[model samples]
Target: MALKLLSALDAAKIQLYHFKAIIIAGMGLFTDAYDLFCIPPIMKLIGRIYYLDHHNSDKCSVMPKETQYKTTPTAVVSTLVSIALLGTAVGQLVFGRLGDRAGRRRVYGLSLGMMVLSSLACGFSICKTRNCVLVSLGFFRFLLGVGIRGDYPLSATIMSEFANKKTRGAFIAAVFSMQGLGILASSIVTMVVCRIFAVSSNEPKSETPDEADLAWRVILMMGAVPAALTYYWRMMMPETARYTALVEQNVVQAAIDMKKVLDVPMSEIAEDSPIRLKPPVLPHPSYPLLSKRFLRRHGVDLFCCAATWFLVDVVFYSSNLLQSQIYHRFIKDNNDVNGYKLAFKVARFQAILAISSTIPGYWVTVYFIDRIGRVKIQMLGFLFMALVYFAIGIPYKYY
Candidate 1:
């Protein structure tokens, strides 16, 4: 009988320094998760501060007078709320290119810087100045999205390149998984800040600046701190061996860099095999999008991944946004008139939904992604999502 071990110590050599790179790279991803969560909470605060009621109110009356005259409802607030996701979609395209061309580390550094600046801007910007608020908020959110855009490819590539194949799966997935933790932490912070502000003002979470500004400012400021600290840390980290090899085409330098991360002697790094260089592939200037053979083959997969992300976000966002509506319509007892309890229930529900709905769904990907492949899982997700949406649209009558 043959003794076939899953991971041989000799075959699967991983040094301590590689773990360091993973930690540095993972920080960028953590920031991405934190920023994404932070945006929604800020939007919630903005809605409350401005008294953006779904029902009739002073805040809703703030829409354009022309629209008001026509009785056609304006969706300015909703559009503002969606700016981050829209920005993220654009960022994904722009920063993906930037990462490929300018190098991941450079683009990653730029992304983190953008995130820090955007978060600070978001915290301090004057909401009272409508145009200023609109422009700044949109610009900053877009910049933040650009940063987020780079994080996915950069972090994943860094981790994969630095790690030995034996541990690559675990390390890469672990880094991505931390995003969930950052999300949970951001939510807790937002809820706490909102609670404090709501209590201090003795106003409902539904109620303007009195109930909203302080909490959102604090949360946005909190989101910036991680980016700023991680920026310094990531700055100190070295670029991956794979990226270095591709750029310089120096096999010896690439091996040395790999050994540096592996913390093993030069000879022990690749079992005494001689390092050989290969010619780099140069692309033509006029290549069309579909002209790239490799990209064309996997283009559908890429589109499916993007569509899955879009759908997941839509469900996640809609589920979260509807919490207040659910509470106001069905859960809250109008006779109680105690806003604190109402807010508490809403917070509790959101916490539950965040835990039950979002976190598990993320893990389901981690577990089954390898088994089913990205396209199959994404297709399944989209199919189920469509079914759920259709079911919701049935709209049975209720009192």
Candidate 2:
């Protein structure tokens, strides 16, 4: 009664290939998070290095004199941080449909390649003036964002199609959990690199031009490492059997591919028999996404998902990208600290925060998602987040 590919995939037992697929798809998500979130801790340092005056260190009455050091305007910093989101918005639209049309495996490696190349290019961004440097960095990061955003739909679709029904949710959750690890890795790597530069220098609080510039570059470029490592494996991966059978309508090829991936013999698949291939007695009309029937069926669900995701991301990205600014207010006010050293401190703090809260929350979700059910967990998460935000807001003035 069911399609050969779907039946095979649903019936297959958990095996090595399942785990391999998770890794292959998950690494892209890992790189995505690392590259996206890595900018926060370093944003202040970027401002200090390029926008602020290096020569002045005068103390101020209300706040640190470093306010005077700012040569780069706040708008420029906001632009550098937000430009990637613009790129991602465009990429999601372009790549989402492209994957379905062009084939997932074919476009998968391209996204990874873009991420690797753009990460490196972002690190190496250079120009004569600060404005030019910012412009170059923004362009590369926009490309990087394009690459990272492509991974979202591709990986989710690939994982979902390839996964067995029994453990499909878990498998997809496992893939997404890698994003938390990626975030943690970015912080840890930045902390280590900053520490190395911090200890090597004789003058800890004084900015060394070479080290300050190199540190941010290294942090940005480190994102490319995981993406590059996974590229070969991703290219070798076969297209999902669902896409092969349903989308491409090649039953035999789909069976063969599933055999290789699932490690099951072709003889085991009774679903592929000729009788099962007979046309349905009554075929349903295929409706476009905006058609009345489609809208009636899925409109509310789609709107809720889109709205919820937008709200969550608005909070998540804003909090993450502006974390350094938040922490800076509480930290010791010192104008003497070099940009690199300050960046190091911020990176370490963020790393601790990620390790303590962010990474653990992800693993918990991965383990409990199937058991607790997604809707319930999501509701609970939203509730907790709301409560936390309310508490913070109520006490905002005290800080």
Question: Each model's C-alpha lDDT?
Answer: 0.62, 0.78
lDDT of 1 at 294: 51
Candidate 2, 1-399: lDDT as tens digits: 336557768988999999999998999988998998888656756766675443453433444443455333557767888888888887888888889778899888888899999999998897536678788999998998898888877998899998888788889989988887887888888878778877786753544344567788889999989999878888887788888777666566677678777887677654635643432344345987779989899999999999998998998888777676665565432556666666666667777777887778777877888888989888987898899789877877787
- Highest TM-score model number: 2
lDDT of 1 by residue, 267-339 (tens): 4433344435553564554555666775777788878777767768777666665545544454453422233
Residue 242: error of model 1 in Å?
0.9
Please give the RMSD to the true structure for each candidate, in Å.
6.6, 4.1
Candidate 2 collision pairs = 51-71, 51-72, 52-69
**Local error of candidate 1 at 107, Å?**
1.0
Q: Which candidate is the best by lDDT?
A: 2
lDDT, residue 335, model 1: 24
Give me the runs in candidate 1 sitting further than 4 Å from their true place: 1-23, 52-74, 166-170, 198-211, 268-348, 367-399
Worst 10 residues of 1 by lDDT: 1-10
What's the TM-score of every candidate structure?
A: 0.74, 0.89
Q: Find the 10 residues in a row with the least total lDDT in model 2.
A: 275-284
